[model samples]
Target: MNITKYVLVLLVMPFLFGCNSDDYQYPDKYLPNYNFSIDIDMSLPLYTPLQFTANPVYIDQAGIGINGIIVMNTGGGYVAYEASCPNQNLDSCSKLAVDGIMAICPCDEAEYNLFNGQAEGKEYPLKPYRIQVTSGTSIRVYN
Candidate 1:
């Protein structure tokens, strides 16, 4: 094609399809507002299970988010997600319960992979927080 036509196409292509857009943006309710990190002690009972799909720790001590945070060790890495369901309206049944390697929304059975916090069979993924390894056996999950 022509040089000018090629240049115009290249410039307009990026805008037509967002080159750096994030395809997995969740709604506001699924995210948390508190800007704080909670230090987890692996020596604790709830956190002792570091397996792939084990019991998740309901850490209410963080004093943030809807209910609190649920930390799960994904075998390779650790992920911390908001305890409440991100897709459903805030309700008593919106709390997510851990079953195997997924976080299940009690209201609609919307499951999310705890490893990457991606909601299974849903458009939006689970709301995720930042996790920093503090030590050999400790990590801090922050909003």
Candidate 2:
């Protein structure tokens, strides 16, 4: 009886704690796959109060396996994020709207802090992309 119990425990331990690829699935189309630099004009005001849109001003960072957007924060800082919603894996609703210092998802109302990409109401945070600012004019974003 003791040996049978030990065997059962050993067999179940892997399933309970071991890493499994099945438990994780990357986003199909929304996966970031680009890395490039873009020159942002900081002379004009790009963001409105409590609202920002990346389509008009900023440019997409492109590469072999990464896609991301670079935005000039309302407070004159820059922030970049993976174009996928952390709560839901939908591509259409993945864009985040700036609300003060938080990035709010229009889908499930999940809010992420732009400063650190931490979700405001939930435990899961937004997946952050790598950002490098050079000479205070250009920003390079990567996966």
What are the lDDT scores of the predictions, listed in order? Answer: 0.75, 0.54
Residue 133 in candidate 1 has what lDDT?
A: 83
Highest-lDDT candidate:
1
TM-score for every candidate vs. truth? 0.72, 0.50
Highest TM-score: which candidate?
1
lDDT of 2 by residue, 17-120 (tens): 98775445434443444445444444345523213423223244354223245354434455666545666665677666666556677888887766667775
Which segments of candidate 1 are over 4 A away from where they belong? 1-26, 29-32, 51-55
